[model samples]
Each structure stands twice: as C-alpha cells, then as structure tokens.
Target: MADAPTDITLHQKSKILEVVFEDGATYNLPLEYLRVYSPSAEVRGHGGPMQLVTGKKDVGVEQIDPVGNYAIQLHFDDGHNTGIFSWDTLRELGENYEANWADYLKRLEDAGATREKLWH
Candidate 1:
C-alpha cells in the first residue's frame, strides 16, 4: 500500500515543500530538487530516452496553484512547470527521500554538478 500525506504546505521564501504524513512524519523537499525531478514529459520524457536536466541549481518555484483536489501545478522560475504533483506522489517522495536524494547526489557527483544552495 502507498502512504498518504496528511498535510501539505509550500514555503515560498525557503523554496521548500513540506508534507506531513498520518504517522506524523514531516518532510521538507526543496523546490529546485523537485523541479529537477519533475514527472512531466518535458523533464522525464515519454517513451524514448530520458533526458537528464542539468544546470538547475538556482531554479525556484515561481508559483504553485491547485490542480483540482488531486494535485498541484507548480510553475518554475525557469519557465518549466508542466508537472502535476499528486498527493500520492508527494507521499511517495517523502517515503523515498533518502534513497532518491542519495541517488541524485551520486548522479550530480558523477556529472560534476553542484547545487547553488543547500537544502535542509
């Protein structure tokens, strides 16, 4: 079964997405990191090869709008915001944060990429 988020909040100033689960676990996800890992075809691609997004260290969320009751539409400062982040997806992200983040860091290290700001 998939975990569900109990509450969700966006901290614009800090560029962080906070999610609270029913188990009382809270996760703080950075906007830049989210943007880089967007599920949209523009970022993730469709059927063919996956495109790796680079040089997104300074990217931030320009706006976040509700997409019905299922998801949220995030607008990025870099003009890329087709990703509809669903509650289920957010919960999954929260659950797999450590593994996903570690993999991201490893990819960055392998590509010689560094984030401009630190995410906590």
Candidate 2:
C-alpha cells in the first residue's frame, strides 16, 4: 500500500504531470514517459517481455479520470486510455524514474529506434 498523492497538477504548457506524495516526494512525470511506459496490458503484456512503444514524443495527456479510490486512468492524445495507474505503481514509477528511463533508452537504442520518428 502506498500513500495517496497530496497534490496532483497537470502542467498543460509543459506537458508534465506533477504529483506530490505524502512523504514529501514530488515527481514531474513527462507525458511521453507515461505514455511509453504505460502499465496497460497493451504495453506490458499479460506475461513475458513487455512491448516497446514508440512515436509518442509529441503526445499529450488529454485528461485524468479517477478510478474509484485506487487508481487513475490517463487519457492520452493518442487515444490510449487502457492503463490505470495505481497509487503504488505511481509511487514506484516516480521513485525509479531514473533507472526506468535509462532502461527504456537503452532498449530503444538496442532496437535501433529513436525517441521521435523521422520527419518527412
């Protein structure tokens, strides 16, 4: 069980979701990061290796819908609304942001992919 967020703000201009936990820990999670690392079964398979999501560098968060008192569904501009980020998952994502992001980057590199797609 994780402490609920004391505050949650969507910085529309910056495309970042700022969350402050009860323990005085705050995280400015980027929309792209959240979109790529979505906890949805689409991104994370039911089992085995998770899928790699790409071409979401300019994606925007459309809205946040509360799911009872346990999680929140992030509606993305890409029309993705399957992931429900629970309090504990959010805390883990925030706490392990650096490591997770590094791993994602390395995976992208290994796959010969770029954060953003090539422009025509």
Screening candidate 1 with a backbone cut-off below 3 angstroms (N, C-alpha, C), the clashing residue pairs are: none
Tell me the tens digit of each residue's lDDT in model 2 across 1-120.
787898889898899989899889999998888988899999998897888887788889889999888788999998999999998888888889999999989999999898795678
For model 1, the stretches where C-alpha displacement exceeds 4 angstroms are 1-6, 116-120
Model 1's lDDT to the true fold?
0.77
* TM-score to true structure, per model: 0.80, 0.94
Q: Which one is best on TM-score?
A: 2
lDDT of 1 by residue, 1-120 (tens): 335467778888887889887888888988877887787888778876545676677787878888777777889988988998887777777678789778878887887877654456
